[model samples]
Target: MPGQENMTDVTVIRGNVYERLSHVIDPEIGRSVTDLGMIVAIDVAPSHSTEGVRAPGRFDVTVHVELTVPGCPLTQTIQDRIDEAVASYPGLELVPHIEVGAMDADKLTGLVSSLKAERRENPFNKPGIKTRIFAIASGKGGVGKSSVSANLAATFSALGYDTAAIDADIYGFSLPGLFGVHSQPTNLNGMLMPVTAWGVKLISIGMFAGADRAILWRGPRLQRSLEQFLSDVWWGQPDVLLLDLAPGTGDMAISVAQALPNAELVVVTTPQPSASDVAVRSGLVALQVPLKVRGVVENMSYFDHAGERLRIFGEGGGTRVSDRLTDALGYDVPLLASLPLEPDIREVGESGRPAVLDSDGSLADTPLASSFTALARRLIG
Candidate 1:
């Protein structure tokens, strides 16, 4: 009986090991063999059960590494990694087996495409994970969009909600500095863990790259990189995942649409007519993805003059954009709140502190804080 149970345990462990091993990427296909469904079988038996070579506690594992295409060059890379991962487990020994298989090139490519599609589907709606996806976008830049995204994510953490933010701005990545985090993402069997900052979880190109450097990439290259970001990172299902979207509609936005079809959108804009008009375009662009625009936050709605309103950029831009979105989208787009222009807003972002946290006294009544808190409540609920 003891021997029988041990055999069952070994079999289970073999499957788990294979699952873990699948996370490893093949250099050629840019995807893991597991996602490709190239893993065929797993077998495990106590080394001692064999006629010779008795290692009592140790079990031997053999994993079938099937190639999607015949004569694939990266076969050995996959085998070596599987061998290493299985060997790391105590009470186990690994044996690698490589098999050559063939799928028509078109079928192989289709498999890769479907794997990418499955990931962007609502993981929240799926049974396995509790990750919430949030896309933060602005009508234009210089309206504190990135700063608000970083701080709101940080604030959610202070309130005890596990939060994460992604800088989807491809070319204009500013997330690393906003959180003051610096480090290349650590790769575990090819899966990278998200970096933590101020109690919030984050992923940004800035972490993997330099701020002063220009990322010169063609559309295909950009797609591949963003695609890898979603598939390769182990996000671990936080309460929410925020994205700092770039200022206009282009390839990056379309990629996000393809990947996170269920993603919710939050639009940010300043309280200026021209800004509002431009910001409206962002909402319209999101409509192309058909993403639901939850609400609107008016940044720099005004410059608070102590107890008086210093109507700097004029009022109602938030309301205007909200009304326009509601009309165009045929629903109520509540102008959530307005953020008063404050000099400290800049300082906090540069210092890696959110204005909502570093500033004192009734910030709730302040334009920016008011909008941020209200938006947070709406999105989270």
Candidate 2:
């Protein structure tokens, strides 16, 4: 019965290893390693002392993994995940030896083909998609729309939600600069992996420079670029997706509505009649399209100076836009947030990080972060 018991033990251990690995998700693909055909083989063997005696309750596990891409930037992350999963096995001392390599041409081709087939067309446009699509738009420029989008996205990510953002403003793209993402997305067999910055997955034309940037702007229509961003890029399934649309009432908002039928529009405006006047027009696009006007955000509503909340940009602009849009659209378009005119929003943001996020990437404990967190929760609800 000793031989049979030994076989049984090994079988149970192998099964347990597989179970642990099932929870290890690929950072980019958002699928388990087991599901992605990454786990080529799992070999479990009992450990032996130098004297050739079997060590009880101890084993050596060799996992042969074939990554989808060669020399993936996140290879170390995957390795760390696998190591943790193996080393933390319950009630046993297991040493993991991971054998990492890239999928060969044929294997990679099959994987990509399978993934593309499963993805089909734009995944977000499909019915019953769980992703909450928020298109952040503003009637005019300099309203900190991009800044709001970046901070909101960062807040969502810090709050433990999977978040992604698209800089839908192709001509005046600023997300790449705000998030401080300088590297282009990894192109794997025509599929682009969004650059992860400030805990948010982001894609923007600004990520491309020189000729590539020019090419995106040259011949294709605005709608076409938006379509490519939706269809061509692999977004996986983020809990929230924010699109920082170009300022002014333009085709981008309409394009978003046409492309993403489930998108909700959040208008950004300063606390002044001039900005709020146009901000109302941005939300009014909901009438032209079937999109819903989510709410309004008043950026730079005040400046905190010497125990006084100074109305630097005036007031009631967000309320005015909200009331106007609510009256026009026949729904409650409440003002979601009134962000302050904090200098860090621009200075620190220009340094390539969301001002709402502290250096550690967590939401800061400032009033700004608190307002954004509340705004994020409200939008989700």
Candidate 3:
């Protein structure tokens, strides 16, 4: 009777474990373990006591997982998800044992081929794709365009959006350092997986180093790099995508318009007239291209010292950009937010963390975070 009961339990638990694992997603691929063919097998057996008797409602679940690659940085994350799925089975004590291995050459090849086929060419260009693309640009350098891109991407992720960012500023790539991402993206065959940092999926030329970086820079045309980033990387249809464009009103913006017709431009400016004057031109590129000029963000608008707000960089730069773009484009391009000049934005950011977020990766409870949250909501709307 005991043996018969144990057999019944094993069958039920195995089925349940398999079902639960279907909900556990592989972080990089953004697909369930079962769907990705990673779950080679699920073996469930009753737990035996020291006396060699079956322990009621207790079982050991051994999950055989074949990862796409060996020594994956996310291997531990996937294992933890599996462990949580098994251990949380209702009304029973399930101990999880995960045996991980890399997929065989043939199997890995097949998987990569299938994924590539499904994601033919640039995924964002497909009609009916639900990704919101925002290209952050500035008229010139030193306007904090990259900083805005990095922090805004982090805010979107913290607010529970499936967010991705690109350091479209090829030669001036800064998102990698801002987000504190050090490792290169995991290359699966020919496809690349954007490194996840501060909850945002990110790809940048800065992530590559030495020969790899040189190889990317070998091509004469700058647009080729943007094209490769769009097609070569597997993006999995993010809800919001941000691009930190290279400072100036040139090739990158046009490339984005051609590659992503639905992209909206967000111009960044400082409180100074010189920066804002050029920033307006950055948004005016929308006239030449089909891209929409979403709005303007004035960074370093002021400094909050004690109870008084000091206009450190002068004032009305955001307004100047917004009004000029609105008049030139014949659309309502409002000044989204006037961000304060804070030292933390620089200090924390240089330390490889977005200032809007805490060390734990959640949005920090600060005025800057609030401004970003509001800015994110407006952009999405």
Q: How does model 2 fare in lDDT? A: 0.90
Residue lDDT tens for model 3, 270-333: 9999999888888888889899998999999999888999998999999999998889999899
Candidate 1 lDDT tens digits, 1-381: 756887787778877787777777654444676776777677776666456866756776767666665655445767677677777765555544444565666765676466445655334446556666778788778777888788678667666677777788878888888777876665433455567667676677787746468888757787676667776665556788888888877677776777776677778888879888888888887667868787788877776575887878887888888999999998777877677688877876788767666433123344566566766776788
Relative to the unseen true structure, what is the C-alpha lDDT of residue 311 in candidate 1, on a scale of 0 to 100?
Answer: 77
* Model 2 weakest lDDT span, ten residues long: 211-220
Local distance difference test, each candidate:
0.71, 0.90, 0.91
| Model 1 TM-score, all chains together | 0.64
After TM-score superposition, the amount by which residue 83's alpha carbon in candidate 2 deviates from its true location, in angstroms, is: 0.5
| Index of the highest-lDDT prediction | 3
Clashing pairs in 1: 139-279, 338-367, 339-367, 339-368, 340-367, 340-368
Model 2 Cα lDDT, one tens digit per residue, 1-381? 767887888899999999899999988888999998899999998999999999999999999999988878889999999999999999999999999988888887787788889898788978789999999999989999999999999999999999999999887889988999888887878888889998899999888757244433433488888888888788898999999998877777778888998999999999989999999999998989999999999999999899998998789999999999999999899999998888999999999999999999998989899989999999999
Which stretch of 10 consecutive residues in model 1 shows the poorest summed lDDT? Answer: 358-367
Q: Please give the lDDT score at residue 164 for candidate 3.
A: 95
Q: Which candidate is the best by TM-score?
A: 3
Candidate 3: misplaced stretches above 4 Å? 211-220
Ranking according to TM-score, highest score first: 3, 2, 1
Give me the runs in candidate 2 sitting further than 4 Å from their true place. 1-7, 49-54, 209-220
